[model samples]
Target: MQIIEQQIKTKLSSSAKFYGYIPDVSQEIDPAAERPSVLICPGGGYVMTSDREAEPVALNFVAAGFNAFVLRYSIAPARYPVALLEVASAMKLIRKNSAAWHVDPKRVIIAGFSAGGHLAANFATSWDRDLVTEYGYHADEIQPNGLFLGYSVITSGKYAHVDSFKNLLGDRYGEPELMSKVSLEKQVTKSTPPAFIWHTVSDDTVPVENSLLFAEALEAHQISFELHLFPKGGHGLSLGTSATAIKSNGYGLEPTVSAWRDLFVAWVQNNI
Candidate 1:
């Protein structure tokens, strides 16, 4: 899909600071038509986004008949809620201008892997209702049609990166209540968006338990979801790009961590 380059530097919660635009992509099949959209959050453990996070995934979204935006959210030297705010704002802007971009405000999805996965879950679960009540924003203002957590971190208790929490909250993590509130697992409700999740069993960095716990919560709530756990790839093996992806060309994405990309595409297409 051919796209125009748009770099929009938007405001953070502080409003005084500016987070870079993080390149975004748009496609109008017809000059006067709308399509599904996706907001891509890249992973870097709160520091940087991997190449795989920013490029390949964004391209795949585009090829799948959707408008995709790769959010180069602010990192470490910056803060946590900052990245969260940037993503929320980006979503709001996308929705507000959905008509111009030919996008279906109701079909917008958020996807991320690893740390990016963490934020994706947080924004979908944490920011959804609070951003509405606190800011007087309508449900239309900030909403995600669905969630795609690729080897993500949804719970903040056991498998979280303590250092990342420190960088994002400074002194906030000490507030156990606040931490619990932000933990994605605690926020699941009968109303949480439908989610499609995948992670490897061998993952050690963030742990597959993050996906397990979140998937469990979704099941309990009866929300629609699909989980794929490969046998042996470790953490960050997004869609089988791990040493396993190199070997089998896919990490159970198909079966034994194989053809996952295709599996995800098939699911997304049928659902959307």
Candidate 2:
């Protein structure tokens, strides 16, 4: 296996970083294999990126026969398009080195949790816009083939995770129109990629409706999607197992919710 770390700089900020976990090919095996990749974004309510959702999640996907990446994207102090642009930069880098990384550029998926989910979903739905082009990337260059959102922050409205929006917009948080514009449910379009989304129905922090709203939008647009609403659990349950559990709080360990990782891998196998 190869571990790669690169600084991801964009016009907005230079604080973001990218980490890749790629399996080394065997000479007697599939040396020329090009595998699918998942770029993960850990959720932090746009304040900070969670360690629980970073490398552990990436390695699990790597173990499941796919190259995986973790994006420590810019957070609160960085604001809005800064994180979005950093995500685009990471995508551009992944595609640029697809050959060397043994990655199938066409099979790239973006996965995120909480606020990171909003960033991933935003890029999935808005990658074709001129904003990305303005940042020196062709819309197609930053496109994601699939989306995997875990208890994400999708809306800026009633179901919105208020602090995530406040942190993302900063001064613009006061602007109702701008706030509404960042509401991902309103951003979905026919061009958006297929998605596999999951959220626990009892999550009070970010709310289950955030995922529901986005899935509804995907369905309304006739886009392909698979949504799973777990009967119970709270927000920010990375793997929902002891592997990602917070030692002091024991916050992440939930046997039932831990199944999301396997389900996601299967979804990729059958869909993406």
Candidate 3:
């Protein structure tokens, strides 16, 4: 395990954020191996990145024979495109260093939880435009091959995750034009990458409808995607196990919900 951390320098002066993770070197296991990499964005509703979702998720991917990185993107007071640009920069850097990292650059995927899911979804939909061009990067350089979203916040409508958007847009939160622009379900297109999405039907924070709406859009566009709506679970389950729990008693942990990780890896192997 080779650990590395770097400051992601993007077009935004204030977006001097950091990304950290352990790189997978295939030579150690099989000299000819080159594995897919996952860039993880943990949920914090655009206010803060969640610790439970960051490194734990990365390690899980690593254990599944994939290289992984955890991104600490900009949050509240940073504004839109701040965190977005940071994600792009992180992707660009990972791709640029693919050889040394034993990575399959084209198979690089982005996985996010909760509000971070919104960011990942938005990036999947918007990487080809807006900030990619502004940062002088080809869309392919930062484009995710697939998106893995966990209990994501994908709507700005009736089921909107209000605080997430408020933090993302700052003063522009309620401006119809900008609000609609970040309403990810409306932004989906045929160009959006294939996705693996999961959510709890009973999630009170972000709602299952958000994932349903996104899945419907994916279906309408003929994009390949897999969605899992668990019968029961709460928001921010992270790994849904003691490993991700911040308390003494396996807080927020649900055995059935934790199984999503395995299902997700299988989906990636089969679909993307």
Candidate 4:
């Protein structure tokens, strides 16, 4: 295994970071083999990136036959479009180095939790627009083949996770028009990538409605998607396993919920 960390070059230099977990040449028999990749965006409601969701999630993806990356994208004090732009830059860099890393650029997936989920969904729905074009990248260059969202923030309304959107909009938080603009559920189109979204109905932080709302939009657009609503559990349940549990006490661990990982791998096998 090889680990490579680098500062993602952006229009404005910032603290945003990108890390890749790739297989070394010796690990694979075929030098020309290209594996599907998953780029993870750990959620911190835009204030910071969570440690629980970063590497552990990447390790699981690696164990599941993927070259993985963790994106610690720009957070608060960095407003709207900044993190989005950073995501675009990360995709470009990954694709740029795809060959050397033995990654399949066309099969790259973006997975995020909480606010990061909002960002991933936003990228999926918004990538084909001027947001990426201004950076000299064609939409396809940065477009993800699929989205894996975990307990994500999908709305900007009453059920919204207030702090997440507040940190995202910054000074523009009160702008009703802008709030609706970034309310991702309303933004989904036929062009949106296929998605695998899961949320626990017991989650009070971001609410399960966020996922349901987005799923409805996907259905309206006739886009392919797989939605899972676990009857139990709460928000921020990274893997629903001890590996990503908040403490050794098994904080977020739940047997049934942990099965989401296997389900995700199966979905990837059939889709990617």
- Give Cα-based local distance difference scores for all models: 0.71, 0.91, 0.87, 0.88
Mind giving the per-residue lDDT tens digits that candidate 2 earns over 152-251? 9999888888889889999889687787779999999888999999999999899899998998999999999999999988888899988899999898
* Number of the predicted model whose TM-score against the real structure is largest: 2
Better of 1 and 3 by lDDT: 3
Give the least accurate 10-residue stretch of model 2, judged by summed lDDT: 128-137
Across 243-272, the per-residue lDDT of candidate 1 in tens digits comes to: 224444443233455466677777777775
Give TM-scores for every candidate, taking all chains together and pairing residue i with residue i: 0.82, 0.98, 0.95, 0.96
- The number of clashing residue pairs in model 1 is 13
lDDT of 2 at 236: 87
**TM-score, model 3 to reference:** 0.95
lDDT of 3: 0.87
- Please report how far candidate 3 places residue 241 from its true position, in Å: 0.8
Q: How accurate is candidate 4 locally (lDDT)?
A: 0.88
True lDDT of residue 209, candidate 3: 97
- Give per-residue CA lDDT, model 4, range 57-165, as digits (tens): 9999999889999999998888888888888888888888888999987789988999999989988888888565566667767888999999999899868999999
Count the clashes in each prediction.
13, 0, 0, 0
| Alpha-carbon runs more than 4 Å astray in model 3 | 14-17, 23-29
| True-structure lDDT of candidate 2 | 0.91
User: How would you order the candidates by TM-score, starting with the best?
Assistant: 2, 4, 3, 1
